[model samples]
Target: MRFHVLTLFPEAFEGPVRHSMLGRAIQRGLLSVQIIDIRSYTHDIHGTADDYQFGGGHGMVLKPEPIFDAVSDTLSPYPTRDRHAFPVVLLSPQGRKLDQQLVLELATAPGLVLICGHYAGVDERVRTHLATHDISIGDYVLTGGELAAMVIIDAVSRFTPGVVGAADNVQEDSITSGLLQHPLYTRPSDFHGMTVPDVLLSGHHAQIDRWRREESLRRTLENRPDLLDSADLSLTDRAFLAGLGYVGISSLLDDGFESQE
Candidate 1:
């Protein structure tokens, strides 16, 4: 997968994307990222990318011309009419909240153009005409969209087949599986007074799998019970959750799951 980031502060991306999993993915040719400085497209001598709003806003709004030119120039090489044509995404607090489902959707794209909004925000024209999608990391605001773009890049890359070492790893990821991941313990099974669960140490694969499922449910119930309503739960799973006093099981049934009882 390829990601093109359009930002005024292109220098900000140098460290984050060039290290960790993203770096390794680039090295192996599983993914590619191109940072396009929005200022470069500006005609002004100072490379001015923002200007005071016409209606007298507190912060400068990103100019439409530079953004439009940058995106158009990037997309000019590809057939614009195709379904797989690169998508232009503007990262803004006003956008739909990013989630596992949206990440899955973006991973399928051949490439992505992420517009990192700054100051007051990108011009309305940029969002209305140029951007194909607008996405937010969460409900809150950020100083700029650069961090959010990096986050989307990392997440979407995970679904690009070879970026992650194991296919099962992607499948079993916390939100991808619709539940919080079960706790993991390694080495020093006996620490202080806490001992590793015997099922994990017993070399009993079936019992270990059962323990993991139950723990996953317990953690999700305790931390994020809302997930269980949409998680693909087996009758056995529901029974386990019910036994643990997860009262939201009724909502799951209302969504059309057959009651285990």
Candidate 2:
């Protein structure tokens, strides 16, 4: 997968693109990131990419010319047939909430163009016409879209082959799995007064699998019960959750599994 990031603060990405899993993916040629400085496409000598907004705004708004030109120039090399399918994303607080499903959807694209809006935000034309996706990391606000762009890259990159070691690692991820992951323990079984669960050490694969599934459900119910509304749940899973006082268990039941309640 390839990511073309358009930002005024190109230097900000120097660290993220060079470290951790992103770094490894770039090294292995599984993923590539091209940072396009928005100012480079500006007309003036100072290369100013932002300007005071029309009809009076509190802060400067990103100019549409530089953004449009930058994106156009960055994608010029791609075959014309695939250009229409490319995702041109504008990171903003008012856009679609970033989630695992969206990340997976973006991973299917051969490449992406991420517009990191800054100042008061990009011109309305950029969002309305040029950007294919307007995405938000969460409900909260950030200083700029730089962090959000990095986040999208990391999240979407996980779905790319070889970006993460195991395909299961991405699929079974906390939010990706539609549930919080089960607890993990390593090294000495006993730590201070806490000891690892016996099922983990008993070498009983069946018992261990059951323990993991139950724990995953318990954690999700405790931390994010909203996921249960549409999470794929078997009768056994729903029964387990119901035993733990999940009231929504009354909604439906799978075939051949009568409610144990």
Candidate 3:
């Protein structure tokens, strides 16, 4: 897959794109990232990319012409109307919240073009006419969108084939499976009076799997109970959770699990 990043500060990406999984993906030819400086498209001697807002905003707003030109130039080689064509996404707090599902959806795309807004924000025209999607990492705002773009790239890249060392491990990632992952322990099974769970050391595969599933459920219930509403739960799983004192969804609704506070 390919990713094109449009930002005023292309240098901001140098460190991240050159290290870790993203770098390895690039080396293996499984992923490609092109950093395009938005200022490059500007016609001014100063390569100006932003200016005062129309109605007088507190900060400068990204100019529309340069952004539009950059996106158009990038897509000029492909059929823009095709569904398989790359997506032009703008990073902003107003966009749909980024999540595991969104990451998976973007992974299916042939490529992505991310616009990292700075100062006040990108002009509304760019969002209305150029971008195919607007995405946010979370509820909070950032000084700039460069960090958000990097996050989106890393998360989406994990789903690309051969990007992660063990593809199966991605399926077991926290939140990817709609639950927190079970605890993991390595060598020194016994340490400072703390011993590894006997089930893990017993060479009992079936029991190990069972223990993992139950522990995952217990952790999710304790840390993020809200996820259970949409989590894939079978009858047996529900029975097991009930055994751990968690109210069944049906019972919760029927009796109204009111907060003691």
Candidate 4:
């Protein structure tokens, strides 16, 4: 798959997209990233891409013309290349919360068009008419959308078909299961004062599966209980959770949880 990024600081992406899994994916031809400098599309003499907000905002808002032109030029040959018009994703704090399901969905898209906003934010016109999706990494605000775009690009790219080491491992990831992942241990099974769980070393697959499931539920119940609300619990999973003192979803939503009913 291909990803086209529209940003004012295209140089910031040079080092990142060339290293680690994203780098490997690009090298292997499993993923492709094209960075387009929004300033390059600007018509002004100074290559300006932002202007003072009409209502008098504290910071300048990203101009819509350059962003629109950048996307238009980037997508002009998509149909001819057997690629669909990729979803235009605007990074914003007010957007839908980014999650595993959304990552999975985007990983499967033919391509992605990411617009990184700066200063105050992108103009509302760009959000309303240009972007097809808006995503937020979390509740807090960042200085710019570049970091959020990188976060998303890394997460989504790793799951794209041939980008990762194992397809099955990717599918069995923590959030995809709606539960925290079971502990992982590699060589030197003995570390510090801890030893690897015997079930893992015993070559007993059934027992290992059971242990992993129990541990997954336990970890989820402790660390991120809100996950239980949407978890696809099986009969065994429900029974295991019940045995661990989990009464229901509401009882686990908050940290230091307590139930009245």
lDDT of each: 0.89, 0.89, 0.89, 0.87
Q: Write the per-residue lDDT of candidate 2 for residues 1-261, one digit (tens) a residue.
A: 989999999999999999999998999999999999998899999998888978995999999999999888888899997888899999999999998889889999999999998888889999999999999999998879999999999888888888889635777879888889999899699989799999999999999999999999999999999998878888788878867867764453445445545
Candidate with better lDDT, 2 vs 3? 2
For residue 139, model 1's alpha carbon misses the true position, in angstroms, by 1.0
Q: What is the C-alpha RMSD of each candidate to the true structure, in Å?
A: 2.7, 1.9, 3.3, 4.2
Model 1 stretches with alpha carbons more than 4 Å out: 81-84, 251-261
- lDDT by residue (23-96, candidate 4, tens digit) is 98899999889999999999979999999989685999999999999998999986855445478899999999
Q: Once model 3 is optimally superposed onto the true structure by TM-score, how far is the C-alpha of residue 171 displaced, in angstroms?
A: 0.9
Shift of residue 249 alpha carbon in model 2, Å: 4.1
In model 3, the Cα lDDT at residue 56 comes to: 76
- Cα lDDT tens digits for candidate 3, 21-139: 99989999999999999999999999999999887759999999999999888777777564346888999999999998899889989999999999989999999988999999999
Model 4, residue 51: what's the lDDT? 96
Decide which is better by TM-score, 2 or 4: 2
Task: Give the clashing pairs for model 1.
Answer: none
User: Where's the lowest-lDDT run of ten residues in candidate 3?
Assistant: 252-261
State residue 65's C-alpha deviation in candidate 2, in Å: 0.7
Among residues 3 or more apart in sequence or in different chains, the pairs in candidate 2 whose N, CA or C atoms overlap within 3 Å are none
Model 1 Cα shift for residue 247 (angstroms): 2.7
Model 3 segments beyond 4 Å from truth?
A: 80-84, 251-261
lDDT, candidate 1, equals 0.89
Model 1, residue 157: distance off in Å is 0.4
121-184, model 1: which lDDT tens digit per residue? 9899999998999999998989999999999998999999888887449888798989988888
